[model samples]
Target: MAYKKLSEQVQELSNPQRSDLFVKQFREAVREGKFDATFLTERFTMPKTFSRRGAEGTYQRDTRDMLFDVTPDFEAWFEETNEALAQTRRTGNVKPTAENIAAGLVDFKALAEETRRKMQASYEKGQALGKGRSRTSSGGGASKTRSRKK
Candidate 1:
């Protein structure tokens, strides 16, 4: 299926109402056994043009663009980084740096592949369970059942 533009998707995620709607739609699709790896990749992958500038004027987009969600690993890293920054501000013990954050950030490529595999497996299982259409014919080329009298 055709997905929305990357910019538009980012904008939607940034908006509270739009993000909630998107999440709801995504959940419904998954629950209905309609989601797959292709859908996940298309919806979550970031475009190449996106990037962020650091405090020291260095541009870093390659890594940041890889993240599709705020995973637990990234959250832990963020908390650590925040504490480090706070410590630096209070005691001037160490310099604040983005390196720690970068190091702790999720590897989007690996995450994406894992997600795709898991979702694909679930989709196949659903199809096998008759939640989705089967590839093989149920019988032959024509209907076998007779019409009932009214």
Candidate 2:
């Protein structure tokens, strides 16, 4: 079976209903000894960069270069790193220390809201561009020159 990337797995888990299906599949794979921990570890440490073609022949990076792990230790570390960065931004001072890093100071809810707003804006921009192109093409005049006689 082809290995699914961590991002794709996370997207699958995003829906509450799909979570049960994922868990079922995971348990069955574990029982069959088909689960590969190395794949997950590698993906967590260093995810592959993915790009997709965009409008006007442009290419956009579709996946974020962020480490994702389901382990408790990794989860704690991730939260701590985010909290430290948030605190630094709020205080306008960089205090790199174990204590500062350990504090859970980040407001994840606000961050999620901001991200949602940005995504919505980008989606709207794409929609407008698509509509504009169709309108321009539909109203464009055809060439008036006639073909030469064979």
Candidate 3:
């Protein structure tokens, strides 16, 4: 017997009957700290020499986006979508019914929008709280001057 490729095997996990199991196992793993989420940061640089303004020195600015874990929402959505799809297929429907497609689309869109809004709110709140604190030099900038002893 020929063995299925990794992608084909992974696709089997989406089968409606396996979706709940997959979600449960994944959530358990998450709760056990088996998975780590990495936050993304963007680095931007100001050019040292400007075409018209001449040399002003270069510097890098790093900005961090908000962190929000929507794994639960996503897992819920995935399981529901798979169930709907399975039901549609089981009913001898060659194509997905409008309701099935619409329901999945509406739910996914709402989840995405809600997640975005929550992330933005959290980011803004963090910024507000951070405003009261002063930023100290971490020493990653340009070279500092040194004094010589006699």
lDDT of each: 0.43, 0.47, 0.47
lDDT, model 3? 0.47
| lDDT per residue as tens, model 3, 1-150 | 222221222254545344334434544544676543333363222212223347566433222322324455545754665565456544353334467656664465655688899999999999976864535344355668878899
Q: Is candidate 2 or candidate 3 better by lDDT?
A: 2
RMSD of each: 23.3, 20.8, 23.9
TM-scores, one per candidate: 0.20, 0.30, 0.21
Please report the candidate that would top lDDT against the real structure: 2
Span of ten consecutive residues with least summed lDDT in model 2:
59-68
Error of 2 at 140 (Å): 1.6
Q: Using TM-score as the measure, which candidate wins?
A: 2
- Cα lDDT tens digits for candidate 1, 49-148: 3335553433213111112333454335434433443344233433224563356555556666888999999999987878434544563557779899
lDDT of 1 at 99: 61
For model 2, how does the per-residue alpha-carbon lDDT over 1-150 read when each residue is reduced to its tens digit? 343454445343323223333434444444564444333333232122334556344322232222223555434533443344334423465344556545745455655688899999999999999999999988867977989999
The order of the candidates by lDDT, greatest first, is 2, 3, 1
Model 1 bad stretches (over 4 Å): 1-104, 131-150
The model with the greater lDDT, 1 or 3, is 3
